[model samples]
Target: MAQNLVLIAGATGQIGASVARHVMDRSGWDLVGLSRRVQQHVPCPMLAVDLLDAEDCRRKLGGMQGVTHVVYAARYDHAGGELESVDINLQMLSNLLTAVKDRPDLRHIHVVHGTKYYGHNAGPGPVPYRENAPRSPRPVFYYAQQDFLIQQQGGQAWDWSISRPHTFCDLVLDEPRSITLLVAIYASMLKELGLPLRFPGTQLAFKSRTQFTWLPMLARSIEWMITDRTCANQAFNVVNGDAERWSALWPAIADYFDMACGDPEPERLARFPESHSDIWCDMVSLHGLRPSELSTVAQWAYGDYVFSPEWDVVSSMDKAREHGLTESIDTRQMWRDSFDFYRSHKIIP
Candidate 1:
């Protein structure tokens, strides 16, 4: 067997964190972590290097021997909103690909592709986006990013795989990504207020769509794509095998918080409580949400896109399943796990 030296860029991130740990537990790969701040020792050996500098990335990575796989999960976290995502993500990916262009020992490249790629904000995508479907320029980043990979994949020697996942849940010691997180916290607040029965939205936009994957499950899929021969050079959408609505999820969160909730009316959320804002810190001193600090309650709430059954994201798992990877996690349970962990870790305060 060939020495499976896997190089993990951005190992400190949520997905990257679990990927390293999962590889350690399930496989025999020698891991190399790349990050700007090597503050805490991760689960694997690491190299502290800035990947933004193309030459630095290439030289340091080029000098490394036996790196059979590379997982590029690192990107700029400093940018506000989605403004800098495209340039930052595409540039970093392009540089990394350029760095390893001449290396033949590498067998797989697993890139952490986000959701915006499927459709633009409040998009009309073909529900359950298939890998073979038409590529949209909406994400702005997807086109360029895909171009880089397609250009590389054309070569007979280089092997690559794209893992497009909906919002990742239950990250390692971090907040969940999908709007569901906000839904849980908001429901908790409503419960604390002793509201009546929770109301399901009558609107028709989001009712028909659902897709999500827990962090661990996604990490497993990414690992399979990197190591398994069947997954080579294929693009796959990975999600747990379950679905639900905010109304269905609110009760669980309300129960956990020991509060009562009724049908959410326009009046209740009309005031736009300070707790619901993305910048929660600014509003904490004004309201008494019972927390010591203003933890953004709406982080999980899909921003400006809140009509229940109004909008959605449905990622297809067909490609990955075809590649012999069909592991699944319960969506509701996963969200509950993330909420429990966030509360325990004091991340939601």
Candidate 2:
């Protein structure tokens, strides 16, 4: 009896999961989640899908009757610092669109993109990256995917919008790519070794201004853009309204762990888990913490990439504000709250 039936692709990822909850809460829409793995904890019916397999996409999404909107938050797996396959990523989106675009009630499709679109990973682009900035000289799947969406929507009744968010933070404890969980687990390991908390990146990185998109606010913004008619056929940058340098926050983080703040020591955070596996095990047993392998708790390669950005990574929020999605969160307070959640949930000792 619901007016809308929304299909959330990549539903098990942090963005997809959080957005699913927010869409359900705000609009009372019927929901379905599409991902390779089925999560028992997700809020809606989950379709185990293989977006890479065109036949699988057809079998699963081809007949999703009454599906009114698609929130494509899915990404093809790729290692950090590696070139993502443009063909593979584009095919995934193309498969999803082919399967569902003909649905009579389909009104909108929303794509979740990231700051990598601005070339933050390759080095840095212009500061406060505006939505209208030219495509990065480097090859990225984002360019291919966005272009495909625009091409496919040429004469279709449905409309599309894309959101470009930077590193997004949520308090979810078990997420492997979480920046907050990476920091929590790293600090716990270092504390167990009786070492001071060190800023584990270059001096330039420590002092660089960066921004984060609070996950909940991003979910709300996605919901706003999809339902609001004015946001159609456009792309907008979604981020915390403010930015900060790690140098300004390192002291507070050190204080939170009750440890001294040491000088910046550039480290390959990807090496931490294997190097300190024994320490992690000891901490888990000593604190009676949940049993989980340290490697499974956080992917430090993601940490390495996040902590190694030596240039300022600011994205402008003016476009989203002008488009009428004005929600914002304090980045520093967002971090503190995330750490507090991990502690309350006993995800860290």
**Per-residue alpha-carbon lDDT of model 1 for 1-349, expressed as tens digits?**
4368787888988778878888887646678788877857487777877777888887788777776788978777752235446787788888877777667787778888766666634456676678777766554666677778878777646588878777566645333344555565555444444565354344343244556668788888888788777777677887785656655655565666666645545332323454444444432333433343323334333433344335555667776777798798887677777667666655453
lDDT of 2 by residue, 1-349 (tens): 8888889999998999999888778655889999998989887789899998999989888887899999999988887778889899899999999999988889999999988888988886788899889888888898998899899999899999999998888877568888878888887777778898888899999999888898999998988899999999999999988888889888888888888888899888888877787888888889988888887788888888888889999999888888787688987788889888988888888
Candidate 2 Cα outliers beyond 4 Å, as residue runs: none
Give the lowest summed-lDDT range of ten residues in model 1: 292-301
Instruction: Compute the lDDT of residue 174 as modeled in candidate 1.
Output: 31
Lowest-scoring 10 consecutive residues by lDDT in candidate 2? 20-29
TM-score, prediction 2: 0.96
Name the lDDT value of residue 111 in candidate 1.
Answer: 84
